[model samples]
Target: MLIRRAKQEDYCVFAAIEADCPGYPSWGANGFAAEETNRNSVTLAAEFEGAVAGFVNFWILRPQVQLNSLAVRGDMRRRGTAAALLGKTLEYARKNACTAVDLEVSELNSPAIAFYLKQGFEVVGKRPKFYNNTETALLMRKTL
Candidate 1:
């Protein structure tokens, strides 16, 4: 799997990946298009066999990185696509002198929680009803 910067043409596939994981918040094609104007935003796409397989978006806020969104195609899970994307994020963090990576995951998403834990993230807090004011959000952080 190859992880690289996302292009405008890849937004649709990114959106589809978001859809493949239900209950995950989505930034549709238009939303991703708007990210082009954010100087701090970094969006990455994972490619497998020449096809887009997943995506991750984050912001490099000096001293830290805020992981905003991440998703892998349902058929591509456990193939290291998500891990590669995250590895790139950590590379960016180290390059930028960031000290930590932060993100929030839906409390009900067990797979994601496990993934984050396995990736060295610790639950630092929680925001009740953070997801559509319905599901709780587990705030996790990895101190780099």
Candidate 2:
């Protein structure tokens, strides 16, 4: 997969990928468009076979990178799309002098929890009912 900076055209497909993952928070095309106005935000896309298979968005905050969102096409799961996106995000963090990566995942998302753990992240804290004020959010972080 080719992981690269996200383009305006990629938002539609990225939104679809987000939709495929039911229960995952989704920031539709408009939301992504809003990100373009944020100088510190970095959005990336994972392309496979000429199609957007996944995407990740994060904010670079000097010593830390806050992972804001990530999703993979339903048909493209387990194909390294998410991992590639994340790997590239880490590279960006490193290049920008970031010392760590941080994110919050829904507590009920076991797959994501495992994925984060596999990527060397540890549970750092929690926010009760942070998701839709119904699901807890597990704060995870990985030191670079």
Can you write out model 2's per-residue Cα lDDT over 30-142, one digit (the tens) per residue?
99999999999999998898988889999999899999998888888887788899999999999999999999999999989999999999999999989888999999999
Off by over 4 Å in 2: none
What is residue 71's positional error in candidate 1, in angstroms?
A: 0.4
Displacement of residue 77 (Cα, Å) in model 2 is 0.8
**Which pairs clash inside model 2?**
none
For each candidate, give its TM-score against the true structure.
Answer: 0.98, 0.98
Predicted candidate 2: what Cα RMSD to the true structure?
0.7
Once model 1 is optimally superposed onto the true structure by TM-score, how far is the C-alpha of residue 132 displaced, in angstroms?
1.2
- Span of ten consecutive residues with least summed lDDT in model 2: 72-81
